[model samples]
Target: MSANDLPSLLSVALLARVGPARERLREALGQAGATLVLEEDPNTLELQVLRDAAPGAVLIALEPAIEDALERLDPVLGSPSLTLIFDEAELAARREGWEAQRWARHLVAKLHGHLDVLPPGSEQDGLLQPEPGLPTTPAQLHADAPLDFHVREAFDAAGDVPADGLYQAPDTLSEPMSLEEALAALQPPFSTPAAPSGPPPVPVSAPQTEPPRVPLGDHSSWSLVDDDAVAAVAPPPSATPSAAPPPSDFDIARLSLVDLEAERPADGAAAGAVLVLAGIGGPDALRRLLATLPAGLATPVLVHMRLDGGRYGNLVKQMARVSALPVLLAEAAEPVQAGNAYILPDDVGLAVRDRGLYFSADAQGVQVGTLPPSESAVVLLSGADAGQVDAVLALAGEGAWVAGQVGEGCYDPTAANAVVAAGMHAGEPPQLAQHIVERWGVSE
Candidate 1:
């Protein structure tokens, strides 16, 4: 629909599961000025209801059973006028105060296709009222007077001085006085005289005595003690130095560069996947890192990001706008491919099988520990889960090249900070991307 054709008040079709969140969603929509044309459980909603209502937007509160509901509503997913908003049930259920306000603002913006929405009572709609009996013209206002007249009126009212003069001395200092008279007035009233001088006294003397002299011997020779006698009187050494042991023959055989190379894994097997764990501020960080990477990168990258329910589609669309690599929602049984990014959905389990990545319908905890360190690497970016820090550290210990997002760009760096404290590499997105490219022999 054209931007100008958008309505100020939107009609919404809320297809949500029956729960407390649904009622809250209804109230929020109402607050946003949206008229509820149809409200029904997502599973029971039919395509005909949507067609008849002609709602400006569709709001779906995603729950665990959302996949089935989505499958049922597949036919209407392709509508051109459909502006779908997917809010997580947990977030909606707990909306209060600021959360409710935020949701309402977002809903109104999406309905009107605008980024800026004015709050209630802020629109420019009516004329402002003037003060009662306020003058409207120059003739009605009081005539301007000189500055001196106002000063005179103020002084006269305060009774501080005469209006005709600017300065007035205090009553005590009204008359003039000589400098000598002022100095005498400031002096003390009483004074004291000096005491009489005393008579001088006489001094006494004492006698001194001299020391007796001694005679010097004619011979200068003196007796010398033997060094051997002094050594005999001293204690003997406690222990004697032992002879050094012979070096083992095994220690002489040094491992050469060839031996070290032989112990290393094959290049193909060593070049493993790069897993990116992010949350909160992940989107912008992911965008920057992905844009810098060339399409020649051989390591398959898996992104496990936390997102609100039903936002995966929008996330993919948003990432594609800035990324050079292909950004797609991961599907089950898809083989791991180089130069492609797979975003993990909340519903599925991510696993590696037969040297290929695959998704499973069975829900499981994200098993980052299973990735072989010799062939795998991980980049902890922005809002990565704090619980994954220990697992990522263990992976690093197994020879994995682990890195993290650092500096001001990373909003939630709890996981990243932990990874850094464990002696792993940390930098901005572009720097991390460069490290990956250089380590894996990627083109850029």
Candidate 2:
């Protein structure tokens, strides 16, 4: 062991089966800034032994055999004073060299206190390459972006407001004047001419002149010009256009895919699955959820994330990189399937058929009726539309495992908040994923 393996400030209790795993974990705990107070197989460890040790933290080397070991050590495991750390024995046994050192550093950080555990300076994926040049700001750009035109125009269109500010009481305020006196101060059209305050003179009216009767002469006013020099650029009268060949007899779909029954949504009925809805800031939540989902998930995870410019294809590729299951674009008229994730586009809509759901173009948004209320689940993630909150709650009322992403890392929590307000489960992406797996009883 290196010098870093010296006893740490914190004391830790290790619970693992008596074997190479226990031996390795014993060494690892020492290297990970922890002093071992007790090391025993959880299956046989006495409750008194844990109480006597009373370590500040507990390290559990997890494996299939120790699935119920925590139950045996429930008293220690449930202690509020002790921090519990679990790591896969298989994965821990494989760690060596740099991997072992990195794990130790992370363990130390966790044992002590830190915000985020990460590489020293940057992401492990790759180094940050600085750009050679930065984008030039347009010279004509306004200091402040223009506001709504209606708001700007509303202030001055009627000329009600002055340049300086709102009008104030005039210093020379006058008493109320008579109606006629008020009218007399205005202009001729504005005022009523004061009704001519004298004897009525002979009513003089302007003469109505009859329109002149001018006889129309065809081509007389029109100029008759001699033909100027012209070149022969007209199409030849002898030229005849050739006819197009008839559509090939081999044509089967009648020149339109609509004629094919196989292409319609009803032909491929929906196979009910889990529906996950999100918008902005959803991709990261999706990554965590998909990453934690256990293998061999029977139901399909349909991700409906509305993106600008209909970038579903790009989304599918990005998700496929992180997702354990194959990511596919939800095509129109295709039935929802199992064992894979489908990225639903804006145009693709849902329809229920025989208690199942399928994608179609006739509608938009989640069709609550199409979803098997009892069988289907709805997970509202970050940036999900709040409009669907009622629908998800309705499903929840009908026995669906409706959930919302917790406030953490959620950019727009309107929808999730609504679901949570309605008393649905709210959790982080991984926690939600675990609930879903457990609900389906398909997780290992």
Best by lDDT: 1
Summarize candidate 2's per-residue lDDT along 269-296 as a digit string, tens digits.
Answer: 4456789998766776887788787656
Per-prediction TM-score to the true structure, in the order listed: 0.43, 0.41
lDDT of 1 at 315: 64
In candidate 2, list every pair of residues with a backbone clash.
270-357
Off by over 4 Å in 1: 1-9, 117-334, 339-385, 393-444
lDDT of 2: 0.72
- Model 2: how far residue 290 lies from native, Å: 1.1
The lDDT of each candidate is: 0.73, 0.72
Q: Which stretches of candidate 2 lie over 4 Å from their true place?
A: 1-271
Evaluate residue 16 in candidate 2 and report its C-alpha lDDT on the 0 to 100 scale: 84
Q: Report how far residue 133 has shifted in candidate 2, in Å.
A: 67
